[model samples]
Target: MVVTDENPSAAPVTVPVAPKRRLPGWARSVLWAVGVVAVLSTASYLTGVNTLTSTNTAQIALRLALPILLAGLGGLWSERSGVINIGLEGMMILGTWGAAWGAYHGGVWAGLGAAIVFGALGGLLHAVATVTFNVNHIVSGVAINLLGLGVAKYLSTLIFQPLSGNPRQSPPVPTFDTYSATFLSDWLSGLEQQQRVGISDAAGLLNGLVTGVAPLTMIAILLVPLSYLVLWKTRFGLRLRSCGENPVAAESLGISVYRYKYVAVLISGGLAGMGGAALVLLAGGGGYLENQTNNRGYIGLAAMIFGNWRPGGLLGGAALFGYADGLRLSGGGKAVLALMYGLVLLLVVIVVVQLIRRQWLAAALGVLGAGVLYWIYWANDDLPSDLTPYTAHFVTLIVLAAASQRLRPPRADGARYQSGQR
Candidate 1:
């Protein structure tokens, strides 16, 4: 019969305190590094010292960046699933050979399919070694790389031997005539035809931009968003991430960690294979070579770390590295290019180490160092040819540095399901 009236003016009911904003440390570092790179790269263009004109630079960056981005995405999946894939280069090489062989014999579609199959197989081998056999991830990865390279080289030699006579160079993959025309015209329009365009020298600039937009380059772009969706939105992705983060924990939850790890690694391989196929079909004219993948695999691994294992971030990192690669290939100060790559790798290492050690200052300094090096490279016009060997060697160093960070399996990755564990 009696209802006691609660105080009408009680302090506005506050729900239990909201959690404080906490940005991920890795994310912060990525942002900072990316920002610094963007500013420096932009400045280089404005100064006209790097020779990578604004439009051409972007095109080169995109063309170079795509394969690496794809590879990085693949690496993200495998590593996230708790399997380290050191053989990404090998997978790419194998894929390149397969694609080249298929295209030479069967056409473009066949080459692509073959590359994908080989890549998947590479992934399978990696999975078996690290997941099923519990092999040391690093050693297993190295073995895969060696195996892939040997197999590819042996097959190529067998097919194309007799040194001077029947060198196995496949015909350039056939393109729709209209496709080439349209692209060439657009490129010309962008450079020479524009009244506002500078008059100093337009021929070289036009050539560079046009060449950069290979058909495969477009495919790489499509893969970026697709990979993001696959990694974050699907059931399979959840399982893969779980396995990578804590295989044992995932196993306890009744999730088959081994199965997921196997699948993830294979998928990663498949993508890398696609990357190879793209190179051969789009860049290499359906032809196989001794080191056909051109170290793109290693570059991809670095991009993966530079991107911090996220698809978008990976894409950005890939573009940066790819631009640098393009510069090297296009006769843009090779020594400086080498130094740029080295500095980038060093920056990545420092950031990763700092994260591991919780040393923010070191990470900051590392990034600053990278920016300064890039500036110096941008400023230098006459690079030494003798340093070419050294620069070439740095490619391996870059890959190794990136792989080292990923060598140790993540704590929760590759977990296998056991009874009563879920």
Candidate 2:
């Protein structure tokens, strides 16, 4: 800050004051998300696009988002520790088999436990190949993927064929108990039905959160904050991340680069295993089946990339894709077309934000995009049937394109590391 001198003939004197502190990166991201949500909710309320905030849509979104959330978190753990875990899919596959085997022989909790162990094993294998033997990270990951698939298949045929009467699937696994905050949900439901703009919008969202959520859902949601605390706030996290950024420097500091990398990879596997168990217990309904993962591991990796390798960013990415998936399943093309309208609103909001930041070119592009999208929305009653199935992928591409400019990975995220070597 500056102030002028009182003397008429005196030159103005500059005064210094402390600059205002800016919000942290995570906080800013959250605020941006909240702003976008507000725009979307208002669009829903005005356009009669109820599906955008419907309880059913929200519920399904939670279910779909869980695996991706976990998988992306897994990638974070590995990458932060200086290892790129492209084997997340393989780990998930191992987890599926472990879950089925444990659930069949023990119970649901046992299944979850077994999955973690199995996933950890896959992680261990990755560590052996990449760290101990100096194998290429991508090559090690690909080998693990094939190995996991083959192992799952062999185990399934040997263990599940007689019991399930099918080689490709397992018998039903008992699901966990579910609970709801009935009172809050009821109140919110009532308010939502009243159709009062922001009030209804808040009620709808709160209602979805409080109504009929599984214990695993709560656990999955909690992991995001827990991860941020551990990875960003703790000393251990700093050391682990150091290995990713500069393993040689970390080793020089006696940080034990190999140890941190190993730990991170194992944790990565365990998280991915949890993702698999989530799929079987929460969404599968049936115990386990062949190819049940449905490439969610790959999608999770995409979510991780979209988030620029941050926990909060990945969470937002996962939720966006999940919402699109659920929308396609529940409302078909009309709901998707409704989403296009909401996107236009969101783009307009983006334009306003860009203008505030004096980003003229970006604001201009946003305006052009919004105009084109709204024109498309106005001309179409529904999306073509052929395009309906790729809704999640479509959204993922757009988001990645929008966010790609800002993404930065760890310095040595996928680089080969050697002890005491730069």
Candidate 3:
């Protein structure tokens, strides 16, 4: 009976909760991107290899990014509706043909409209197969790809061949020479020349930003924000997203899954078509070639994944890919060499840090990464032009490997939906 009655109400032990120690993924990505850009800018200034710092490079990067951005946005819309659109390439090819036909007959504006129509047609076809008929998504996409290229080639032979005397390409299209006034272009151009005279490096970078920019470039840039607002802040977007994530639940809530999916897919096609029109406009004198798309549709898909299907994230991914492409166009300059070496140096430091922390596996991987960069640096002078286009892909692969764990696709995506199947 003398058992020490444990104080039933003994003071509750208070363990202090640890505050969040890690930065959000976006914040960390921003810091890393800023550091990389700063390093490259300094290298360009120090070496006087202005290609890396020139505004022309910036313009080229933006142009290169635009089509990818459009396609990525299209993919976002389609996939967000629980339908995978692997036929973006096919849609883009169709758009390219449409643009060529429209430009050849009328003008750039007409070409844009034609492209949208063609893309919508492709989207309708895809929806019929994947949504209405419940065909395998991947199979439908593959069939679309083959059919698109064949159709484009057939049309090219009939229309472009008869008109331009060449079946493989279309004649040049009219281009917008400048968005800014003459005075602004002159000022920026003058400042660009002064870069060699010790003016700010940014001056060179601004020279190409405004002068000779196409109207489509401006439109594409505007679409980024417009898409963000429509997809994230609007009621329709919420309903569309619900269909993708949980169609059964959405049906129970009185949402029309089929209607949303159709709209999304069509919108996706229209966006991809716009990308094709932009590509033709970007080519200007070069015009549209039989294989002008060069696999950009697939790249757009990769960008969508890299961005985790967000508009803002797609912007950054597009910029990275575009910058790499611009660098490739520069043809292995000293600035690029410096950048590669700098990356190697950073990886070496990471290896050291990992070793100090006794992270044997991580340190080994860091060593491997450093070695790869060193080899790329060693081969820079003799690197094949054919390999240049793949630099963006390499960077993307590395990023995906490092961060894919954090990415979460919409639930129920690609899953067949039947009413009351819950």
What's model 2's lDDT at 422?
58
Q: lDDT by residue for model 3 over 293-378, one digit each (tens)?
A: 88888888878888888887787788877777777676464545655666676677678888999999988988898788778777
RMSD of each: 7.5, 2.9, 4.5
Provide TM-scores for the models.
0.72, 0.92, 0.86
Q: Is candidate 1 or candidate 2 better by TM-score?
A: 2
Residue pairs that clash (backbone atoms under 3 angstroms), model 2: none
Order of candidates by TM-score, top first? Answer: 2, 3, 1
Over the stretch 299-338, how does candidate 1's per-residue lDDT look in tens digits?
A: 7887777666777767667766765665555545643454
Query: How many steric overlaps are in each model, in order?
Result: 16, 0, 0
lDDT of each: 0.67, 0.87, 0.79
- In candidate 2, position 13 carries an lDDT of 72
- Output the lDDT of residue 384, model 3: 63
Tell me the tens digit of each residue's lDDT in model 2 across 1-422. Answer: 65677888887778888899999986898787677668768778767888877787777888888889999999999998878888999899998889878877898889899999999999999998898888999999889888988999999999899898999999888876778898888898999899887778767767877887888889989999999999999999999999999888888899998899999999999999988888887754548788878778888988999988989989988998888898888788888888888899889878999999999999999999899889988999888989998999878788888988899999989898787785
Best by TM-score: 2
Order the candidates by lDDT, highest first.
2, 3, 1
Measured on C-alpha atoms, candidate 2 has an lDDT of 0.87
